[model samples]
Structure formats: structure tokens, C-alpha cells
Target: MAVSVYRGFHLQSAPNSTEVWQVKIKNHVLTGNLAAIKKSIDWWCETASLIDPREFESLNAKREESTGALHEDFNGYTLKNDTGAPNAWYCFFNGRLIKGSKLAIQKHIEAYLVAKQRAEAKQAQQKK
Candidate 1:
């Protein structure tokens, strides 16, 4: 059983005898198996109006995330794409975990680096 949240949606997967998956977006609640939930989440991520499916594709054409054939690196951290849908990613930073899109993890790493730099500068000033 695993519980994960994405874009304000809570997705809980319980691999029991029934293999049920429940999703909650705000007050809206949906219950179904893994396939059903994946479809629903994919729909929610894309626009309501019909458009080219290619438009939703990521800029990184060199690698397809859904295949899990490859992984990317960000700030020296390995970004394992858990699911192409909802753009879920698992970025490992010394066991620190972040689950989100590439941009989300980038922002997180940027913030961490900025804080680290500030702390180092403060320590240097104190020693002077």
C-alpha cells in the first residue's frame, strides 16, 4: 500500500485482494483500480478541450520517461521518473526525497543550494 499526492490530488494505492486505488481532488472523490486511476489522473493533467497529444509531450525527446528506460540528473541527484502521468519524479539527495515534476525538483534543489551558500558565507564571516 502506498499513498502519494499530486497537484493537490491524493492518490492512495492499496494492493490488496481487490487492488483498489482511491483518488481525492479537493472534495471530489474517485475510487477504482490502478488502471482506472491512472486514466483519470492523465485526463486531469491534460487540458479539458481537445488538442494535439504531442503538445503534452515533454521537451526531452531524447528520453521517454514512461518507459523507465533512462533517468536524468539534477543538482547531482538522480531523478527517477516514477510515472510519466502527473509527471511524478523521485529525486534522491542523500536520502532526501522529493516527488514531483522536473521543474519542481529543480526549484527544490535551487532553494537548497541557495540556503547552503548563505550558510557557508555566514560561517566564513563569523570566522573573520
Candidate 2:
């Protein structure tokens, strides 16, 4: 099975500080096994919660908002706008909007893909 990974994050803007936290997954990693991915994502979100409780609350409140919560789709995870279009500036994942350059996201994505592929292969060999 092929794994797909996507990157996502949350952005917080305040008078004094602008903070961003993001995560990237390899292609099909999340989509191929939604349950496992969701659990991993939820765990990450919990970790983020320790950093800023308010951010977690904000995510919970806006859970219904397409861009505010984790989105799982064929194209990959993304932060949707009010119109339900993927936001170019940031992709929301694990309860955050990741703010970074395309290159940065791509690098993370590649690393995740390689790691996931190796892990899946190992699991398959173990099953045999």
C-alpha cells in the first residue's frame, strides 16, 4: 500500500507575538489509514495544547469551520477557506495553521514520506 502525507499547522497572531506550529506527513500516510493518522494527529494536537491552552480552545470552538480543524482529502490535508478552498498561505493540521515557505513544507513532506515508506515496508515484512 502507498502512503500519502500532507502538511498542516495553526497560526496565532497577537499584539506581541505571531506563533506557528506545523506538521508534515508523507503522501497517503494519513489517508491510507485514517484511524492511525487521526490518532497520531490528535496526539500531536495534545502536545501542542501544552504549549498554548488558548490555541486548543480556539480550535475546539472552530471545529466546525473547515479551515480550523483537520481535513482529510484525496489531494491531502489542507486548511480550507470560508469558501472551502485550500488556503495557500497555511495548511491547518492537528489544530493549527502552519506558516512557512513552500520549500520548507516540501522538505518536511519528503522526509515524512521516506520514513513512512520504510515503516510500512518493515510492517509488511513482519506480517509475512
Candidate 3:
């Protein structure tokens, strides 16, 4: 994935609050870390759409072994709009609007998993 396909929060009312700056790129408008995204337009672009992580787990019957909450909503910090809406952002590639925080978290999770895999592989090789 290109850098321009990722978006996330820029400014929040609180440390964990979801209210953020809104931005417009081309024909699509997105709300998040407006200044940061504008600085790195390509990387900040919305690339993929994501469903809520918890709902997905439940629908797939892939419950976790240990649990407090059944599902984890990565966008908890994202504030609902005036219409009580969880606003979304647009992808630079297709100009498709998507959930900003969820997509950003998804991208981070992907990067973390890949890094972990690589580290495990390296450690295994070093042991051999």
C-alpha cells in the first residue's frame, strides 16, 4: 500500500476524543488530522474501507479466548458528527470515502503484524 492511502486523527477535543480537523482533497472531504494529512497527502489518503473489528469477529464466530469487551472499536476516540454520525474520509486512489480511524488502525495493525513476522523469521534464522 502506498503512503497516500492511510488517514487518521489530527486534532481531538481531548486526548482520546474523536473530534478532528476536516480536510478536502480533490472532490472528497475527510475529517481527521487535517494538517498532517495535508503535509503528506499521499500517505494520508484513504486506501481501504473497513468494517468494525468487533462486529467482524462476532459475525465470523472468532471470539477471543480472554475477553472484557467482545469487540474493540479502534475509532472510540473519533467523535460522532452533529448528526450523530461517525464521519469518514476519502481514499486518494479511488476517491472513495471510508472510516478514518478504523482504516488507520487497520493499516497500523497490518504493519505491526508484518514487522513481527519478519522479526520472528530473523530470530529463527539466528538460532539455526
Candidate 4:
């Protein structure tokens, strides 16, 4: 279907496939992502129709997966109540300032947190 009615995700036909009756998971177009599948499982964990990937060998996620985590959490970063700039968001990370719109501040915080986590993980691996 060429419609956005499917919640989470669904199968859709490829454009200019050069073949008849071919379909692929709609979100796979983005990669081997699993946000949609995880959402489906969240909604219908028991009664609907979802099998746990960890339990079932056939339902394996051999590639990438999305945890569906919210990116807007403060996560140790503090927000400043608009200091003269209209419609702007000021974010402070341990005293360092980052000023922008709300979305920009959130993006910055998410990127910082991800980088920090990666760095710590790498450091631990070096220790090992």
C-alpha cells in the first residue's frame, strides 16, 4: 500500500521494481531497523500477533535494532528559561552553554549523551 495508514510499519511494494508482486517490509527501506516491529510487539505482546525474537530462532534480528528511546529527556542537561531570545532554548551541560531552538537543544543533548556513552564504553574496552 502507498498509504501512511499503517501504524508502526507494514509491507509495501517497491517503486520501479521491474517485477510483478514483489514486496518488502516498509521500514527495511531505511535499513534492517526494528522500531516498527518493537512497537507492534509493545501494542500486541500477548493476544495480537508477535513473537519474541529472543525466544524464537526464526524471529531473529541479525542486524540493527532501534530501542525507541525518547531523545528529549533532560539527561543531566539543564535548560535555561529564555534569556532575551524569543522562541529560543538555552541548554547548559555542566555549565557550558548551547543556545538554540527547542529542537536544536534536544539534538545537541542527544548527540552529546551518545558520544559520552560511546567514549566510556571504548575506555572500558581499553582497560580490558
User: Which residue ranges in model 1 land beyond 4 Å of their true spot?
Assistant: 1-68
TM-score of 4: 0.37
Q: Which has the better TM-score: candidate 3, or candidate 4?
A: 4
Looking at model 4, residue 75 earns an lDDT score of 69
CA lDDT scores, all candidates in order = 0.66, 0.44, 0.41, 0.49
Instruction: Indicate the worst ten consecutive residues by lDDT in candidate 1.
Output: 50-59
On a 0 to 100 scale, what is the lDDT of residue 14 in model 3? 27
TM-score of each: 0.45, 0.30, 0.26, 0.37
Clash tally, candidates in order:
0, 16, 11, 0
Which regions in candidate 2 have their CA more than 4 angstroms from the true location? 1-75, 79-88, 94-96
Please tell me which predicted candidate would have the highest TM-score against the true structure: 1
Local error of candidate 4 at residue 47 (angstroms): 74
- In model 1, state the lDDT of residue 32: 66
Alpha-carbon RMSD of each model: 12.8, 22.6, 20.1, 18.0
lDDT of 1 by residue, 1-128 (tens): 78877556677876673567777654566676655565566776775433222333332343454455337877787878744545677777757787777788888888989999999999999999
Off by over 4 Å in 4: 1-73, 83-86
* Candidate 4 residue pairs that clash: none
Judge candidate 1 at residue 85 and give its lDDT.
Answer: 47
Pairs that collide in candidate 1 are none
Instruction: Give the TM-score comparing model 1 with the true structure, all chains together.
Output: 0.45
